[model samples]
Target: MKLARRLQAIKPSATLALNARAKALAASGKDVVVLAAGEPDFDTPEFVKQAAIEALRTGFTKYTATAGMPELREAVCRKLEKDNGLKYAPEQVVVTAGGKQSLYNCFQALLDEGDEVIIFAPYWVSYPDMVHLAGGTPVIVPTREEDGYAPDPAAIKKALTPRTRAIILNSPANPTGAVYSRATLEGIADAVRGHDCFIVTDDMYEKLLYTGEPFLNLGNVAPDLVPRLLVSNGLSKSYAMTGWRLGYAAGPKALISGMQLVQDQSTSNASSITQKAALAALNGPTDTITAMVNEYRERRDLFVAGLNAIPGIRCRLPEGAFYAMADVRGLLGKTYKGKPLTDSLQLSEALLNDFLVAAVPGDPFGAPGYIRMSFVTSREVLQKGLTRLRDFVAALG
Candidate 1:
C-alpha cells in the first residue's frame, strides 16, 4: 500500500487525540478528569434548537446552495454589521461545515504548492496541519506568553515574502485564550496594507470574551482591508453549537467564490437544517451568549487563579475563550518517581497516567514547557482537576 507524502507532514490533532484517550480511560473505570475539550459546556439555546426542529419538521433537511442558504448568509452579514461593525454581502460569504472547513477552503483556494502561510506560534493545533495538507508551507513565528501570545505586527511583517499567501489570526484564541488588543489588530491591519497576503482572522471565540471591550476585528479596524481579510466565525463556541457544525466566512467576493467552489467540489453545502439553526443563533436573542460568557468568566477566574497558586504551575490570566496554558516550565529538570520529567509531553503523560487527569501538551501547539487546560466543564470538575494537578506537581522532586 502506498501513502501520500502529505500524511508525513501532519499529525493528528493533539486535543482530539488526548480527548479520546481520556474517554477510553474513563470507560475503563479510571477516575479520569479530562480538561482537553475546546467547546463551551453550555447547551445550545432553546430558541436555536426550536428553530432546527422546525426546519426538520418543514422538510428543510436537504442540501443548500454551495455558498450557503441565502437567509443564513444574510444573517451572517447582519451579525458582522451589528456586532463587529464590518459589512458584507451574502455573495461575499461562504458557509462551511465548521470554521475548520472555511480555513481549509481558504488554504485550498489561495495556496499553491510551496506557497507560505504565516502562523503565530502556540496557535490552534489544526492550522499548520491544514496548511501542509493544502500543500502550503506553514511559516511559524514565535510569540511569548509574556506578550500574552499576541503576534507582533513587526514580526508578522518580517515573516512576509513574495510567496506568503496569508497570515492566520486567531483572537480569543484556541488553547491560549489570548485576545488581540485593538491596537495590535490595527497594527497588523496597517502593516499588511497593499501586501498581496490575506489576513485570515478566526473569530470563533468572538462572543466568548471576558474583556469588556467589543470584539476587535481587523476588517472592522481597517474596512479598506476588508476586501483582503477573511473573517471566519461560527456558532460553535459562542452559541454552544459545536455539534451543529455551521460556520461561515465573509471576505472578498472572489475569494468567497473560490472557497465556495472548493466546498462545491467537496462537501457542497453545509447542513441545511444546521444553517437554519445558525440563522436563529445570529438573528435571535443574544442573552444566551451573555449568560455563557458570564459563567466562563467565573470559571476562568477560579481555575487560572488556582493554577497560578500551585508551586510550579503558572497560568496567565486569559482574556477570552475557555483555555489556560499552564506554564510547567518550572517543573522541568525535576524528577517524578525516579524518572526525569524533562518536557511538556512527559509532564502531560504523568498528569494523565499517574494523576488520572487528561491535558493536551503544549509542544503540539508550538509552545513547549506548558500544557493547555480547558475550563469548558463544570466548576466542580475543574476544581477537582486543579487539585489533582497540584498534587501531581507537588509529587515532583
Candidate 2:
C-alpha cells in the first residue's frame, strides 16, 4: 500500500518524539532527565478537578454543541474581555480538543491548495507540518537570536504575497520564549494594514510571562486587525491542564462557523466533562498560576545561567514560557566518539543516548545548531540535566 505523498513532507513532532524516547529509556532502567515536554510540571488546580468530578457525578457525558457549550463559550468570551481586552460574543468562540486542534481547524477552514501561511523560525514544531497537512505552503521567516527571536515587520511584509492567507504569531513563543514587544507588534499591524491575510495569535503562554510588562498580542496593539484575527488559547500551559485537552479560539463569526463545521464533522464537541472542567478553570482563581509562574521564574534563571556557564553553549534569558533555546553551534564540528557532530540533531542524539539527557533539537523547529530545553521540571532535575549536558559537551573532542 502506498501512502499519500503529503506524508513525505511532514515529520513527527520533535518534542513529543524526544519525550517518548526519554520515557522509554527511563523505563529501561536508564536515568534519563527529560526536558523535551512543553507542559508545566504542576497538576491541574483542585477546583478545576472538582468541577470535572461534579460533571461526572451528574452523568453529563453526552455531547452538547459542536462549537462548545454556551456557558463555556461565554466564559471564554469573559476570559478574552477580562484578560486580553478583546470583546467577543459567544457566537465567535469555538472550543476544540486542544489549542493545536483549534489551529488545525483554522488552517483547514482558511487554506486552499497552494495557499501560504507565514511562520517564524524556531517556531513550535507542529506549525509547519500542520500547514502542510492543510494543503498550504509554510513560508518560514528566520528570526535572529540577537533580535530575541521576535518577528520583524519588515521581513514579514517582504514575505507577503498574493497567495499568503495567514500569519501565525506565537508570543512568549515556544522553544525560544521570546515575547514580542509592543512596538514590534504595532509595526507588524501597520505592515499588514492593507493585506487580506488573517492573523493567528497563539497565546498559550500568556500567563507564564516573567517580564513585568503586560502581555500584548497583535490584537491589543491593533484593534483593526481584530476583524481578521484568530486568537487561540488553551488550559494546557497556563492552567497546567495538559491532559484535559480543552482549548478555544475567538474570531469572526464566519470563521468561527467554518471552524465549527469542520469540528462538527470531525471530533464533534470536545470531551463533555473536560469542557466543564475548562469552564471551571476559566472562572477559577488564578492564584495557582501566579505560584507556578513565580517558581518557573526561578527555574528559568537557574537553567539559563547553568546553560551559559557551560562552554560552547550560550542561552538568552527567556522572557516568558518555560523553555531555553541554547545555541550549541560552538559544540558542533567537534568529534563525538570519533564521529563529527555536525548539527543539533546529532548533538541531541549524543546527549540522549550517551548522557541520558533528552532535549529537542532545533532542526525540526527551523533553527539548526540549537537545542530547546524546558525548565518546567524541578530545579533538581534541571540541574542534573544541565550537568549532564555540560559533561556531554566537554566530552566532545
Candidate 1 residue spans exceeding 4 A from truth: none
Candidate 1 per-residue C-alpha lDDT over 4-105 given as tens digits, one digit per residue, 9 for 90 to 100: 998899999989999999999999999888898887778999999999999999999888899999988898899889988888888999999999999999
CA lDDT, candidate 2, residue 219: 93
- Against the true structure, what is every candidate's RMSD? 1.1, 0.8
Question: How many clashes (backbone N, Cα, C below 3 Å) per candidate?
Answer: 0, 0
Give candidate 2's total backbone clashes.
0
Q: Name the candidate that leads on TM-score.
A: 2
Per-residue lDDT for 171-271 in model 2, tens only? 98997999999988988898888899999999999999999888997999899899999999999998898988999999999999999999999999999
Query: Candidate 2, which ten residues in sequence have the lowest lDDT sum?
Result: 145-154
Task: Give each model a TM-score.
Answer: 0.98, 0.99
**Each model's C-alpha lDDT?**
0.90, 0.93
